[model samples]
Target: MRRLKWVSIVAVGLLISLSGCKIVKNPDPDSAGQADANLTDEARMAALARDIWDTDVLPTVAEHLVPIDDLRVSLAQNEQAAGQSHGLRPEGEANPWNFAVSGSGSIVEANTTSRAAKLQVDTTGDGAADVTVQLGPVIRGTAIRDAMPFLIFTDFRDQIEFAKLAGGLNAMAHERLSLPEGDIIGRTVSFEGVFTYRDLASAPEVVPTALSFEAPE
Candidate 1:
């Protein structure tokens, strides 16, 4: 009887030990549902910006770009009409017309530190520049995303994330679109981009989504 009792106790202990050694699978090693949960705020914002730029902004801008000259003419004729025609107007703001513009020009000057450049473009191929195109300084602002008529505050979780998304897109533009400092000087360049008109009377500065250059042909 004593031997039988001892044997039974040993069998229970062995079973417990075996059970402890058994491999337990993690419920979320792939982290599918929890992927965003682990991301930092900046990382999440950047990811969202990249996704939106790829899926919404890029295609929309490409399809809807207005010629820089035409945009200028419209603004000159009537700023309010131009803003409403091609862009979404905030309830009461008069500046920052959200629109896309495209043109080719010679780089008159460049400021790489500021990430901006001035272009002298003659849209009609006239001898003189019809306009001085400001290439950027796109290092900040929610202008790009805000300019998209389809996108609104409700599209994002909050203003903070929305602001971060803009910053992310700006960073991406500087990374992917900007030219080397002196390389663009005197080079003929073509660009398609979005801009916010701070003042209709002043030259429009563009934040380029597509830019290319080569020796003038």
Candidate 2:
């Protein structure tokens, strides 16, 4: 019993010595605060999107834009040729070709039921849908990013960043957009934006950076 008591005392002493030698200080609060202050990937991309939207992105879109009416004809004749002329795609990449286009049309249909909403535009004035304009808080695809010549994929850290930038740009555009509260069928609208499709046979899904609803005249 005495030996056990002596061993217990030695064990306690050793533990106390070890604890004294290894000081476990709390982590520096400032370091943790600084890390928290750092911009998240989404914030970073959104800032980048805002920085470039007017100065770089808009100008680039204008430079590459083809009229929807003309694009339809071009696609009908030779999609590859049209894409080569008006679209942007990496030389050897399998990504879909992206194009900037402008058109004014009547809103024949507004599918606002889905979060991935779309407006069917009748550009021809014949009361049929010519193109689809994406109205998104939830947008799909990276058409804008792929279309911009200046926003090279290699310029970003990786595919995730690039994709987020696309989303940021889409969100930025959505921020500027002001949709009409009531029914908008037959309302005249004009838009300039980017789009992508797997084949020329498919209608363009336009992600409008600029969308203007014409005042009834």
Q: Which one wins on TM-score? A: 2
Looking at model 2, residue 208 earns an lDDT score of 92
TM-score, model 2 to reference: 0.78
Q: Which stretches of candidate 1 lie over 4 Å from their true place?
A: 1-29, 89-95, 113-138, 178-182
Winning model by lDDT:
2
Scored by CA lDDT, what does every candidate get?
0.69, 0.85
lDDT of 2 by residue, 17-49 (tens): 998796787666679566545768788898889
In candidate 1, what are the lDDT values of residues 1-217, reduced to their tens digit?
A: 9999999999999999998796887678568657878887778878877777878878888877888878878888997888777764333474466787888866655555555545665555555555454445455455577666665667778878777777777766655665554556667778887777777555556667888887554
- Candidate 2 achieves a global lDDT of 0.85
Which residue window of length 10 is worst by lDDT in model 2? 28-37
